[model samples]
Target: MSVDSDPDMFSSQTTVASNWSKDERSQKDTFNWAMEMMSHGQYLPLKSQASLNLEDLQYSTKMYYIRQARLACEIVCESIAPSQGIELLTQVYQSMKLKTAETKKKDAVTDTIISAYKKAEDYTTKVQILSLIVEKYSKSELLSFIEGLTIYKIDAARKYASTHGPGQYVTPPKITRLRLSKQKIHHFIEFISAPCYLQVVGFGSRHLKLSSGLTVKVPKVIRTMIASRLITAYNNYCKDNTILPPCRATQYKIIKACAASQLKSLHGLDNYISDGMESIDTLKKVVSNLGTKGLQTSKVSDLIQSLDTLKLHLKNEFRSHLSTESDCSQHCMHFALSEKGCEHTHSNICQPCDRMYQIRDEIQNVMTSNFSNIEIQEKEELEHDILVSTEKNLGLEGSFY
Candidate 1:
């Protein structure tokens, strides 16, 4: 019988049915009580509070309480139809009793839900609730929830690597070949932001499986960015410069700054060069048939050619040389004046410019060139004027003698 259709047993006591057949009564009683209690309207705030406060509990007990709470929630979810599940769950959840504690209330309840989610056997159910919980919690809480799930440990590791670098993490030593088969480049753009994807960027196995199930070969342009960041951070902070890795959260900032200009140009080049691999008409047909069982195949030369052009453009951009001083100031010109001064100017790179400058160079160094060898010529006219001014020695050297 449908849970909602059983109206004969209305009283709280009758819902347990003492005289009915044992098995039948047990099933009815359990289902009825579960439905009633689960539907109780007073526990929503309590359950939410419990999830918040669960984190501070001892690990073992914390795990137990969260499991019970999750089981209770899941049973309600599974037993009810999706159409009414949320409404009923919300109602019953309101009546549940919660352990009330002021301190760490938020963390405790979050911990409870996260622990329960970890032990949940139903993948679909787990994913659904976990996504909800993540959306509800703060970043720190969300990360905590992630830490509880073994599956997302990879993401955690990648986040650490982005800050601490690959050497600190157990990353593959190198990345050689790149395969780019995914239809959309937008996925790669998003991947760059994810911790797990960034971790495996330059080095290691060719095949990568994203949590979302879209697997693709790491393209060369992407790998270079990964390698450049890690290797530079390693060399500078770990050894040569003897400093901590660049400020936390700034690695991707560097990557984005370096890649932005390139992505724009790449779009233009792809639109221009991809004409021959397949006709536009055939290419359009294949795109329309993507992800279907009866899809047909064509040369796709036009599409592939466009993709290649994009890839090449990205490669060039990733490996593009940064010009240190594009517009030389008069001071720089003065510095570049004589052969000796010119050599000095060339050898002594502006600190800020050189730092990001070197990073860009290493990534694109594979087939790229360095900045043109020019002395920073200083404005002698200005310098001579300063020397000739009568107000030059404004300070007194006097009385000590």
Candidate 2:
């Protein structure tokens, strides 16, 4: 299982008091539970405790992973990273039968240890025993090595044998300041109030009533940012002024703190959402009136499916027949079929196709007229934008977008 990436956060992972059973519990069990709580950057832990099972060896009402984690670290002597140490402890967990949580039964690792012990008895003579298992000095010494495999005593012994020293580049990288000065930050606050970034809250005269009984109006962040757009603007400004910009995270934190309670961004999807509702409402009105004597009864799904099929079919259709030349077989396919089109003048005009094209165009015109009515809304929104730039300063005029 993956361990927490930022080990420093929970560095002091000392456990609260618990019974001796806590000491017997293996590191693997505790690590898995801790992993479940670590969700990316948000460190939210679930309150669900593992209920007691009578078959458990280290049986306790409450088992804290904090305590188990500390013990695992101590066993590894801090030589390994906590993640590496967890892997080493897993071998310990598998071999030590007493260390197994509920099983009291021996596992494969434990069985391997037992077999190695029985095999050691045959290595009775000192020199023969040395030859049998790759030239070890004594049978008793060899057996100790085999048993130490379970508890990782061998690893503990070799900890300093491979100790790493500081690298050649000991000096820290020289730091050039990138933090926005008080004036720049103040300029940033003013820059963001520009027409492109923010607008007045469109609530008109209406005031937001709080639980504290305070009434206030909020501003609309014009774009779905203090987003990429805001950052890009900041970087551009810094570049033009021949100064380095602070990191994105730093800028984000500063802006987020400023807008925490009062500002809300106007989402890009908002227009589509309103348009979608209007389209759905129009379709519903058409469907609802179907029962009246003049109208045909049909589902919205059926209409949509048929429309999709017709659109594909119409696009693929060739107006080869409309070509003026009688021998224009190759050139027929080249004719761009629409209300009007033919590289070759019409040898024969298609009345039926012409009528169909006219009807299609008419339907398109009607749909476009209905949908494109949002031009006024768009103009109004643009008017609401706070137009503030080096060249143009149209100070905060309208309420919101």
Candidate 3:
């Protein structure tokens, strides 16, 4: 007969059966009370009552109830008193069963970690949890967690800074710095020993200064100096390793390609040169006008001096190219004469040589003497025009007055 039909037999079964019955009833009562408290938003009282009943509960049952109470308290704390809820959860976590299901244990651990992370007031606790995670978790998991934490902290900081306004100084929480340092260390360890160490070093050194400027509250001058030093060090490393060393020919080719792309036709060379000269003329006129108006001349003087230097450079380049082209033509002519078996002495100039020499002389005259005289004359004429215009303007203004 079934136990239900045999009441006498059930009663005589054993103390173990009776004890099991009592324990089951107690667990049901505790679960019902906890649920009722949670429904009524009595989270603090529920936590206390749950802790009291934990001693009476079986290990498995105790863990399940603790999880439920922790979740309820978290919701309450988030809406009302976060610190109190977190404190309650911490207590429940302490009492959690270690022998629980793997998934449940992981969930409990995660919840605890999250609680630790949210405790900004206690940076030490957060740092401890972060270190523990890094030490225990797989690299991929650690990286994922760190990345999320970094993004969250940065976003929170930005929001706080914006709300506080510019004049108000906002410093990052200590926990954030600790996490970032840990993350950087982890990244360095992971990448620095790899085959692509050079690439890693190149990237890190380049961005380290930028990251510091954006994330840290350092002065602009200091940041710039730090960045310069880092770049210099990276360049030195590249030089030492002969990794992608600079080639002057490659640089020249790149520059030539860029220039060629911008230039539509070789015939526009003279036009471009003339445009540059006209720009200089306009600058001179502006300076003269500024002087006539009795404005600042220091800036104008600096500009005029720079322009003179630029003009000198242009003249030098033109002279060098003229000399090079003339020498090239002479060499070609000489080669042709030798190939023809005509042994012409240097003193005995051929027709081609004579014409080339005359052309070279003309170029030399233009580069060395004619250009300088023309520039002097133009400057004098410009000065005269400026004085005349200034006098005319003064006369007109005087007549109006």
Candidate 4:
């Protein structure tokens, strides 16, 4: 019989054909959905869970999932409404928290790795773990955490190097390189002060460039190092014949002497009169003893006696000057307060004493107008003179003794 005419046979064949077509269409849709999910990074969680055992999951794989989740959250926030995106992000954050908790459950292994990284003894393994942490965490947090770790590590390394001798327990080159790259130069500079810093500078002199451009402060211990370095450089220049320079050791002794002299001066005298007298005596002695060898001893003695007479005359003049200043101050106070017809006088209340009051007011006005400028000018002049004297002294030949 013809298929079109045979109703039962046609109905059975149509049912079989419809079932096969539906099955093929379902398979194609499933394949396409899986491909789409993979393209959007959505298939990793499912694939990881299904194909990998919990023990077989690598740290890199976990980090990949974390990164993808963060990126997906960001994309959703940007492309969709904020509220909906926030809700999705919260779920992603919860997932991250769970993953972190799972990782933390293996505390013994993780702690071992962290300890190794901190000791910096296993360079390759430490670097790997550090890379993983840097990749997984925010850079700001990573940097801050590393900074604190570095401080402890530096102190420990210093102690270890000191105890074992530098040759025996030197910091690993790789760790040093990494630390230098990560550390701020200023902090490193501050950490390395003299005596303690001598070895560091000796090793890293080429790497260090201390200049005005560096705003980092030098500590007191290192200030001596800076001074010594400057002195050594000047000495080298002197050796090259650029200028005459004093013996550095002798200069140091001179500085000590000057400090001692200043302390003595502070406590020994109310004024510098004794210092002036002592200087004059020293000058007279030097001049007398250092005179021409063949010259008459009598002439030298006469010169010294004349210097003594001059010194006595100067002391008398200074005393007289001080007495005059005291007398003038007393006389001025008396005149301003007790002169006849003075407005300041208790008995001169009549006639208002307008002229004297006016003169007094004028004097006050003049003093007020000129005093500050006069003091400023005097200070400036004194500073200029001191600076000139210093320059002249520096330009002179320096004594080694």
**The 10-residue segment with the lowest total lDDT in model 2:** 390-399
lDDT of 4 by residue, 1-401 (tens): 79889999989999999998777765445544554464474433323322576357788887775675565456555455554766766776789876765554323544565565677766444444454343334434344445445444334444444555432433546632222232333322332222221222222212222455654432222121233443454455345445445556644543332211111231242234444455446545443433442335765676566556645433332222121112332213334343354333233221211222332233234334434454566435534533443333222111100
Task: State the C-alpha lDDT per candidate.
Answer: 0.40, 0.41, 0.42, 0.42
TM-score of 2: 0.22
TM-score attained by model 1: 0.14
- Looking at candidate 4, what is the lDDT of residue 196? 20
Considering lDDT, where higher is better, how would the candidates rank from best to worst? 3, 4, 2, 1
Question: What tens digits encode model 2's per-residue C-alpha lDDT throughout 1-401?
Answer: 32387665445353322444487755654654444434232333333445555355253433454454455344453344444766666665667644443333444754554465446543222222223332212233444445443223223222322332111112447988665678767766665565434444454333456679997766443333435556666677668569766677777776765553332522343443233323334333433333232333444345444434433222222211223342333223333323234435535554433333343343344334543554566434422321111012101011111
With a 3 Å backbone cut-off (N, CA, C), the pairs that clash in candidate 3 are none
Of candidates 2 and 1, the better by TM-score: 2
Q: By TM-score, who's the top model here?
A: 4
- The C-alpha stretches of model 2 lying farther than 4 A from their native spots are 1-163, 166-179, 194-226, 236-249, 261-401
State the TM-score for model 3: 0.21
- Model 1 global lDDT (CA atoms, 0 to 1): 0.40
Residue ranges of candidate 4 with Cα displaced over 4 Å = 1-10, 25-28, 31-86, 89-93, 100-104, 107-401
Give the higher-TM-score candidate: 1 or 3.
Answer: 3
- Model 2 CA RMSD to the hidden true structure, in angstroms: 30.5
Tens digits of per-residue lDDT for model 1, 1-401? 75456666455446566545565644445554555676673333222223346666778777766765665675567467655766677666654422122222455766776677678786544654455354444455455436555546434434544555432423447966544444323333443444322322244334456679997664433332344544343334334335334433444544554232222232323332222212222323333333132222332343334434433322322212122232322214333332233432343443332332232233223112321221223223322322322111111000000
* Cα lDDT for residue 249, candidate 2: 77
